[model samples]
Target: MNLLLLKLTLIPTIVALVTLAIRKWGGKIGGLIGSMPWVAGAILLFFILEQGKAFGIQSIQGSMTGIMALITFCLSYAIFARKFTWLPTLLIAYVLYTLTAVVFDYLRLNLMLSYVLVLSYVVLTLYLFPSPTAPPADGRRLPFDIPIRMGVATLFVLIITGLAHVLGPNWSGILTPFPILTSVLAIFSHTLQGSNAAIVTLRGLVMGLLGFTTFLYLQAHWLPEFSVATSFGMAVVINAFINVVVGKIW
Candidate 1:
């Protein structure tokens, strides 16, 4: 099978499952699962397969820096969701995410430094993340919701992977956590439920990034010395362990 076709098919299926899981478990769990490196990991895997191990390594480093942008995005959206409607909130958050990505793109740092910088921002964002004002009201599910979510996920993966060669590892890595799933979840939650729902979802995403950070850090160091399967497997195990610890603490 063609690799891109495989991505288009497999990723959307995973998105659909996660979407269903979100609905089943509630916004916070949804956010937690959603924040996992489903899309980002898949993209990086494709990079390794199609481009080369060296490219994947550089991309992982770039991805660590890009994570800061995701933290900013969730923080911005969480803050704005409390005051503004979904549309304006999304717009402002997207602008901030874009600008932050641009800034991170130019700043050169080794993997350890990037991890430290990102962790600082992550801690700060978690501290600043808005408390949910109220529980989210249940929204009526649309039949097409899953399909729409899948479509959006497919589109994003296609665009990113298609441009991987052109963007190179750095820019591609920067774009990895582009908030496609989070945006979809937030917008839908806001439109259907309310601002509080959106806030909860974004907070979940922010909290979930703890595991994501671990995943990328492991990948950056492990992929060169280990088989891809072994590297990802270990990363997932570590990520799940962190998620459990985070769940207990937070």
Candidate 2:
């Protein structure tokens, strides 16, 4: 791993471990180690954003890499968190690796009205799910959520970017991104933070992404052929997964 990822992954581990140890030992040890994750995550978050200008991130490739790092680093802690279970976390990681490979393509797209529309829908849909009760980095949302929201916004941008990149300029119609089946899992990830939701979201995203993408691939579909109706249909499938995966069908 590079220096940034090292910081992003290691610091959080150190902090969480130190904090927990202090409870058993003393506060001093906890104070030192516990400071690492938050401070590291914050600093690293800024650094990742900064890389955009360091080498002229105006390019899609850089932006895509940046987005990959943004989401990857944010979700890194989940690697150690109890939320992940089953074989699919590995699957999502692999698929995400594939998605990461396309970041450059994602970066190339123009941020047009279509971009705004997709993002608005993702955010709105995410809102419908809401976050589940859990310790919110000290029992409340804070500056911490800034990066989280920023990362998700980047995803919205990505979804839009991905959509526009796949479809051409003249062919405008309601088309979903990869697959709507995974959309609810994205929402569930936002709201719930437990072994159950964690397991479902992780596995569901993988299953859903695979299922939806496979179907799209079979259609021999490219960007221009995608329409808005297809997008909605995909989203419905994603929600169907959420229903089974999270018992949120109602």
Candidate 3:
């Protein structure tokens, strides 16, 4: 119960802060930060605390597979953003995400293989995605925007974590990176700043996933041997280093 309350409070707070940071730094930096394991890391932490390291490892593997879905989501959104408004674009992208998730769920691959596949897809999508042609405009801020985002993020954490028990580690892992935060950010950016802004945001997200992939890779390899504190600490350090490299390259 105490942990549950902590999750409900902590995750949204982090998200709100990140969202504000995005507003301050602009989409590329914000998207890169947003791409960190904020949501999935939190979920896996709770999985370790409640279900044990074995469960966490299994979920991590599942999450690797799930990255394919995230790639699909980004690609779909980027493509459709060219021709459609945010609403229809989001709807269509979501449909693609769902289908991709289902397909990836049934077709399991080893972690290294999954990583290779996902990384390859990311590269292809990045190449194929059209540059945003829309003129830049400042996004309109609603007083309620941050609050709504906070509420929705918190709610998603609750629901996704609760469902993990029923879905088991693999399916839960696949669901871990469901693009909730990305969806919110993309929608708001599209509405306010235009399609190009949203495209930049998604591109940043894909780049940031390099750090995310490293975090999970370390956790999967190290968590079984080390204490959770030690394993997670090392993973964060490595992930931060990789993010720095990515930031430099980007």
Candidate 4:
């Protein structure tokens, strides 16, 4: 298989499918599904395959930091969405996300500490996330919505992977959780459906971060001791299981 071709097509396909699912199931479930490690998972696999498993494992610590930044992005977006439109809300959230990422990268926390701190933060954020007053309104669908999403998301991965050499494993990992997908969903929802819809979607994305964090943490441990296939497969299952449990309770 051509790894490059897979890299180009896989994320868009996943994003397309996730978009369709969101349309079908509504914001929360769609956001949860979107929150899965679709982008980061693929990026890490490529790192392991091209760079080395050791590099991939080392990058997971950075990914933990990325996850924290992601949480801030979603939480801030939800908060700002209450008063502002998508553009301003996204800008504010992005600034906060970048600040969090930079500070955490400087701290250079270990995998275990990053993992614990991220999980603890996820719990606290979930408790604090805004609840939609009502379900999302069914606004008219945007033309080429899914295609645009797929393009933007695939572009982010391509640019990041293209620059992985320059950025190195730690920076690449730190960027793995950047809010491309989250922004797309939030902007569309905020524009078409309204602020509450975006809030619901972002909150659900944060909820999925619980499992997303676990997946990255597990890969750091398992990738060192197991084959890439076996390690990723186990992480996928565990991530799904964690999301399932969290979904049922939250």
TM-score, per-candidate, Cα-based: 0.96, 0.28, 0.95, 0.97
- Top model number, lDDT: 4
Residues 1-250, model 4: lDDT tens digits:
8878997789899889988888998888898899898888998988877788888887888899999999999999999998998899989999999999999999988889888999999999999998888778887788898899899989988888888888898998998888878888889899989988998889889889989999998887788789989988998898889888888888
Candidate 2 vs. true structure, TM-score? 0.28
**For every candidate structure, what is the RMSD over all alpha carbons to the true structure, in angstroms?**
1.2, 16.5, 1.5, 1.0
Question: lDDT of each prediction vs. the true structure?
Answer: 0.86, 0.33, 0.84, 0.88
Better TM-score candidate (1, 3): 1
Pairs of residues at least 3 apart in sequence or in different chains that clash in candidate 4? none
Better of 2 and 3 by lDDT: 3
Which stretches of model 3 miss by more than 4 angstroms? none
- Candidate 1, 39-152: lDDT as tens digits: 888888888888898998889878877798888888898888878898999999999998888887787788898888887787778788888888898897777988998999
Better model by lDDT: candidate 1 vs candidate 3: 1
Is 1 or 2 the stronger prediction by lDDT?
Answer: 1
lDDT of 2 at 246: 30
Q: What tens digits encode model 3's per-residue C-alpha lDDT throughout 155-246? A: 88788888878989998888788888888888888888888888988988887887788788788889889998898888888877877787
Please state the error at residue 124 of candidate 3 in Å. 2.2
- Model 1 regions lying over 4 Å from their true place: none
Candidate with top TM-score is 4
Per-residue accuracy of model 2 over 1-250 as CA lDDT, tens digit each: 4544544454344433433453343322222222221332232223324342221112222322322322332233235234544335534544554454355345554424323433343233333432334432222223444344334433443343334334432111112232121222233333443433433233323222222222222222222244424533554465345334432322
